[model samples]
Target: MALTTDRPITTAGLAAQRQPERNRNVGRTLRRLPGYAAVALLLVVVTYPLIWLFLGSFKTQDEFLNNPTTSLPDSFTNFANYSQAWSSVATYLQNSLLTVLPSLALIIAFGTAAGFALEVLVWKGRQTTLMLFLAGIMIPGQMILLPLFTVYFQLHLTGTLWPLIITYTATGLPLTVFMMATYFRAIPKSVFEAATMDGASIIRSFISIGFPMMRNSVLTIALVQFFFLWNDLLIALTFTTDDAQRTVQVGLLNFTGQFGVVEYGPTFAAICINVLLILAIYIFLNQRVMRGLAAGAVKG
Candidate 1:
């Protein structure tokens, strides 16, 4: 025999039972709306400049003057901006690679190792040394440039690629040490102890255990350092001389002649290409960083 509860509870009874679900849906909908709106606004703000640059690359000075906001070609005339920009841009790009890549490698290698060692290794005055390293972040950029320039002169390294490489690498060390110290410290001490218990020496444990674990943090910071060095014009300008050593920034400045012969087409074209490349790199790495964080949080 089938049985029913009470006097066959009304629709209001069912609604009361599902009240939590309804409240959850309302709360989720309200919270989700603002988050999505924020993301949309941020996208628009970030996109406008890039869109402007890209569209401007296609526009002739006449068209630009006629109507600036229009993105597409007025009549689809052939574009030579990219070609001219490439011809002038590649040389400077190569110079940047030479200076930036080596410096990047040096900074990561030294900084990561230093960070791992400072946090993990048994040593006297470790706290004091770490504190001193952390203090470097407080130093002003310009106050040191003159002394750095003098040192560069004394070493006969000025007007050469080495100066840029060495200076950027060394200058980056402070921040690298600071960040890596924090990340390394976040690692569990027990793991290091286990490695030590396995008869691993100082260098062996660091190489076999510490480095692999810190790979994400290292890559994240290396990219950050690369961006800083890549975009730097002040140090590049101060250290290098002659067209051979001039970076893309100095090269782009050539467009601004004494007269009004601005090469906006080539400049914008070059800039657009770089912006696109940087975007690609950022997207790819950000994905990796996200994945690392998720995996890490889960593992922890």
Candidate 2:
């Protein structure tokens, strides 16, 4: 005789037991449907314009003008517009790099140093100095533009790139300093104390230890300032009168004329170039940016 349980083993019984679990899985998926749909819709809304821009970049002037904006180009091999746009914007792009790179370097170096001294060093008036930087953040850039131009004019620096660099550095520094100081404050003081006992100078400790740990914060600041300087039109236009000193943002204006004439193909190509570069950089550094933001959030 075989040993048997009180209930008989049957497919119907097994199916009956599993039915509630299957229903629960279905309910969970149904509950998440709205969020999935929302994300998909948002992605399309953001990506559709970029798709249009890329397609338009390949079109000739005649094709772009005659065809519907939604239509694809007849040829993707057209490089004429890109060649033309590059030639037109090359000088401006060079000037932009010159202005942005130097400005960013100064901002990072000075901001980090100042923040370290304020937050890490035990010095008199440290709090007062931090407060001053905080106050600088509230001052409107527009209010000081006329005065800055006047001073630049007086110093005979109006035509050069120096004014743009100096203005960008100055305007960018306060926020950088504030954020850096905030980051530095969260670091334990005993770490520096131990290094001091080991015969390490403040500069040596900062270089070897302090600054290295700030990689995420520094990257975050760099990206923020990079985008700002890259996209800025007002400051670039105001400070630069000569075409030689104009940045890429201002250079884009050259594609338009007084009579409403536009070079659609080359304009789209130039814009696509900028968009693609920015996207590439963002994608590359996006992980670091996310980590930096998460660190800041948790640290606070």
Candidate 3:
């Protein structure tokens, strides 16, 4: 039926308009259910473990193990375990930061520079160089450990911070170069050409143009690499024999002597502290990195 009139809408017009409302209701119900369910599931997964850790941090050793199935301490207990762990934690953490911070800076600076040079600057045997660089990434970290140890021993470098710092920087290169290369490949070629035409030399072009564009990816890589080196246990354990030079992971790990009498309270507390520390570093730097990425700073 067709009804045409140059008049205001009647009941049929009202019904026609209401039909869209019905469809919208159906569509929204279908969409909202899955979205809410997924959100709920994610919240539980993230919050439960964090809450458990928080609660257990305050409980007594006996209370923690026995009542952990049911609940944590009724009151906060003023975070006493954190102070208890602080004695060893402070020194080891200082050692970790010292090694990790310098290694991280060298990795980012040298690695990004290496990647840019390899990709953009033409020279003899560039392919061979890249392949050789890639060759290291393929070798298992453990396989190189013993040989590296021999070299370190020969250099009289065992039982000190220098060995770990140098080793962390060396191992970090392969992956850092890989990450920088991937991002560099994605930048537009025109930007590099423009910078070159404007008379910006190689170093200036990279600093003024290329490095800005890949900031986000670089920060992400830095975060991942920093945490990787920071949490490393094996290499640090081997190279660090001086009581004061041991990294936090090596020191904390040594706490649990093959017998599983886990200093669970301190362990959980340290875990929480590590999470917060990493989060703080990323949060502070990620904003600036994102801004640099948004500026489209391309690398040659």
**Pairwise TM-score winner, candidates 1 and 2:** 2
Steric clash pairs (candidate 1): none
| lDDT tens readout by residue for model 3, 86-172 | 777789889999999999999999988887887766789877878888987997888888898899999988877888989899999
User: Model 1 over residues 34-63: C-alpha lDDT tens digits?
Assistant: 999999999999998888788778776666
- The residue ranges of model 2 lying beyond 4 angstroms of the native Cα positions read 1-8, 257-260
> Per-residue lDDT of 137-216 in model 2, one digit per residue for the tens?
99998998999999999999998999999999999999999888888887899999999999999999899888998999
lDDT of 1: 0.80
Ranking of predictions according to lDDT: 2, 3, 1
* Model 2: ten consecutive residues of lowest lDDT: 291-300
Predictions in order: lDDT: 0.80, 0.91, 0.80
Candidate 3 at 253: error in angstroms? Answer: 2.1
For candidate 1, give the lDDT of residue 298: 32
TM-score: model 1 vs. ground truth: 0.84
Error of 3 at 175 (Å): 1.6
Q: Candidate 3 has which clashing residue pairs, if any?
A: 210-298, 210-299, 213-297
- TM-score: which is higher, 1 or 3? 1
